[model samples]
Target: MSRLKEAQKSSKGAAAYSRYINRPLGRPMAATAYALRMTPTQVTIVSAVFTLTGVALIALLPPTVWSSILIAVLLVLGYALDSADGQLARLTGTGSLAGEWLDHFFDSIKLATIHLAVLVCWFRFFDLPDGWLLVPLVFAASANVFFFGIIAADFLRRVHRLEHPHGPAEAPREAWRSGGLYSLAVIPTDYGFLCLVFALLWWQPVFVGIYTALAVINVLMLLLAALRWYRSIRGLAADV
Candidate 1:
């Protein structure tokens, strides 16, 4: 198969929105990155730069629609680049443990940083309830635990050469393809969609409603995911 085609295949994600949308958006950039002979780590770094720049701008800029929109655009670009790096890695046959670590590290940073950035925007601008201000912080902290648990569980399974925990009995389903209801549960946690959420920040009610809803949903989902992964790991160990 051609490199581009292979890269295209590699772009698919477990989330339907990602497979259908984000991956497609990133394909052209993946081709570009390939042409430029960019390394996966370099692509990862560039992705972070774009994403963090957007987050920083959101925190620093005056609370205006224009600033919010620009931040949204930057974040969308960052998400595309994020998708591109893995595709680039697959295309170049440069997938490495170190490269994987770097990719995951960047992902974790944004997991926390994005929420913190939003909190900054709120604290600096909005007159939200003091208790409400803690939601983002809660999300930031809980999300890390979720991520760490998931990754650690996967690592243990890999090291143990255990069977894929959720096989034919519980086939993997893309969050988007699942249903609108399921998608809503999963989508808000997505950084790609979170970019769009920033645009709603200037509108207080819309922003707060979304922020609180997403935070609660995402935290619950993450905790459940972590629990599922932990159970899988424990089951594997028991079988041993």
Candidate 2:
């Protein structure tokens, strides 16, 4: 297989920006890291640095059209690097529990704090009413829950598979094959979409409207997703 093909993972439930844009960007970065003989842990740290830097910028800098664009670039680059680390691990055959733990640790930190950074920016910079602050606060909470729920679901699936090795295997998911419409449908839950939304930070009304809408949509999606995941996980026990 070509290096890119070898590094590619199943898209499965990934949202549009990640499935289509970030993973492709990361593939070449993963190749470059492999050529440099970099470890996945190192790439992970670098990814965290870029991501945290962007988070800090949102909290510290006054959001301008230019600064917002720069923030988007940094966050997007960080996200690509996040993708690259896993691909690099696959390429080098160096994937490990520690590496996965570290990757998820950083992701948890990012998911927990990125929206809080927005909260800080809104408080420190935006001239909004006090009630508006709740948007980011609620967003931050839901985002962390969303992130943890996903990882927990995956962990449970892994354990279920190990426990049921002799039982029937799972049917392969067909979500990715549905292509464009499914991808488009999940855009609100995509981090890359949120990153791009920062580009409108110069216009507070527009930014707030879009951001608030996304938060509401994500919260609703998370509720529905959690229920669906619960049903699926319960089925694993029933099948056994």
Candidate 3:
């Protein structure tokens, strides 16, 4: 009887770990927003507005390095809002497919605007030589690729969860701990962090290098997600 009890405890721990690892970081904010009577759509619109303001400040302001820093700060706020919208919806039981799709659509637009703002800043203020715009352009494309890739991967993960109601046993407890750490790591590695780093290192071409590397990784992540999604659907079809 003791052994059976121990085994059950272990199983429970493992399931808990898996859930912690797979969870996103926006739940708290979502809860707060829901308590405050904000809707997901409202949060989404507010996030976009903040992001647009950041881009405009960066592009149209006087040629000062401080402006870049301010823009970076605003960009971070924009990202936080972006996270809060979905969270609020989930917490408030107001989540819908249309809201999710619109969130993604606006996310892409926000990314594009950020890149364009950076390019305009460099071109207008820094006065780079001809063809220098290509640098920001490349970085921008990479940023978009990363954003879209992450979204795709998340969608595939959700679909898999839905289809596999009871596939295999849950993961080990250690796996969940590791996954939580990985999610935290995303805070430093995300686009907002990249932008802040670029602002600080604008004097060098390191920003360009960082952007390129991030873009490449984004593309790879997207491809892996697409493959996983395809496999999940195929497996479901086979069962049917």
Candidate 4:
């Protein structure tokens, strides 16, 4: 099967088993908005607003288990908004260079703020053991490092492709599947999910452990991507 087909199949299977109940609802709304002539950039901006509000709410809310639950709901809404923006952009043919840049910019802000808000809540409202704040900060920093590395690697890959048009082209199918995985590398959504889990479990330490592991994996993936880009460029130069 082509890489695209394989990726579609994999994604379909994942969606089938996903615990995210809002996915189905999100798609139709995205489609409808696209049909209504809304640009992806608009949707992305809206999503960012929601995300910022959610973070602010979390930080300012009174300390209680219900507050955590409310934050989790907001996180889920933010996720849906994130998905909708991209989908709407693609469906409406409103994708652009500016839109892409804006998407990444807002995404970085959203990710950083979410964790920052959580850390604030933990420090100000709840009393955790000493050095607990460091856990979230470390995880956030590690995630940002990996995110930056991936962006650099992607830029390198594009340059390599431009330099060598015929140098053992990546299987379009594998490229598609890998593209999804690489997208995951960009956002560290897993880290956000871990934060939510930690909030629910009240196990701040365990959340740190999970985020640390994910950061390591993300860094490794970035390294692999960089290596691939280097090899592709080298192969192109050799051909020349």
Per-model C-alpha lDDT, please?
0.77, 0.90, 0.61, 0.60
lDDT (Cα) of model 1: 0.77
Please identify model 1 stretches exceeding 4 Å from their true place: 8-13, 162-185
> What TM-score fits each model?
0.86, 0.96, 0.64, 0.70
For candidate 1, write residues 89-141 as lDDT tens digits.
88888889998898898888888788888788788888877788898898788
Candidate 4 accuracy as lDDT: 0.60
lDDT for model 2: 0.90
Count of clashes in candidate 3 = 0
TM-score of 2: 0.96
Give candidate 3's whole-model lDDT.
Answer: 0.61
> Cα RMSD to native, each candidate?
3.7, 1.5, 8.3, 5.7
User: Rank order by lDDT, top first?
Assistant: 2, 1, 3, 4
Best by TM-score: 2
Q: Which ten residues in a row have the lowest lDDT in candidate 4?
A: 1-10
Task: Kindly indicate the candidate among 1 and 3 with the higher TM-score.
Answer: 1
TM-score of 4: 0.70
User: lDDT (0-100) at residue 104 of candidate 4?
Assistant: 85
lDDT: worst 10-residue window of model 2: 170-179
- The digit string of per-residue lDDT tens for model 3 on 55-82 reads 7887788544676677766776677677
Off by over 4 Å in 3: 1-32, 152-189, 198-240
